[model samples]
Target: MTYNKRICVFLWLVKGGISVVLEMLGHVKLALKCVTERERIERK
Candidate 1:
């Protein structure tokens, strides 16, 4: 029972870590898009 609990905790940590990483990636993508749009407007 203890081993099973440990495994569950480990999985939860992994899932949380993945979500944080994905959120960071999403922010980066949004920033890139904003920059691109600004450059396009400046060009015109």
Candidate 2:
């Protein structure tokens, strides 16, 4: 029973970690996109 509980906790943490990573990736992508747009505008 304790083993099962530990497994569940481990899985939950993994899922949460994955979500945080994905969120960070999205923010980085957005920042890059903004920088690219600014550069393009400056070039024009």
Candidate 3:
């Protein structure tokens, strides 16, 4: 029983961690896009 519980928790944490990482990556992409746009405007 304990082994099953531990595996369940491990899977849950892995799933949650991947989601969080993906979210952060999305935010980073947005930020990079904004910065590039701003720089382009400044150049003009």
Candidate 4:
């Protein structure tokens, strides 16, 4: 039972970590887009 519990916890942690990474990546992509837009306006 303890072994099963450990596996469950591990899987849950992995899932959570993946979601956090994905969220960070999305934010980074959004920030990059905003930066490019600002640069474009500045150049004009």
TM-score of 3: 0.93
Q: List the candidates' TM-scores in order.
A: 0.88, 0.95, 0.93, 0.94
Task: Output the TM-score of candidate 2.
Answer: 0.95
For model 2, give the RMSD to the true fold.
0.5
**Which numbered prediction scores highest in TM-score against the true structure?**
2
- lDDT, candidate 4, 1-44, per-residue tens: 99999999999999999999999999999999999999999999
TM-score of 4: 0.94
TM-score ranking from best to worst? 2, 4, 3, 1
lDDT per residue for candidate 1 within 1-44, as digits (tens), equals: 99999999999999999999999999999999999999999999
Q: Which has the better TM-score: candidate 1, or candidate 4? A: 4
Model 1: pairs clashing at backbone N, Cα or C within 3 Å: none
Screening candidate 4 with a backbone cut-off below 3 angstroms (N, C-alpha, C), the clashing residue pairs are: none
Give candidate 4 misplaced runs (Cα > 4 Å).
Answer: none
Q: In angstroms, give how far residue 7 of model 2 lies from its true place.
A: 0.6
For residues 1-44, what per-residue lDDT tens digits would candidate 3 score against the true structure?
A: 99999999999999999999999999999999999999999999
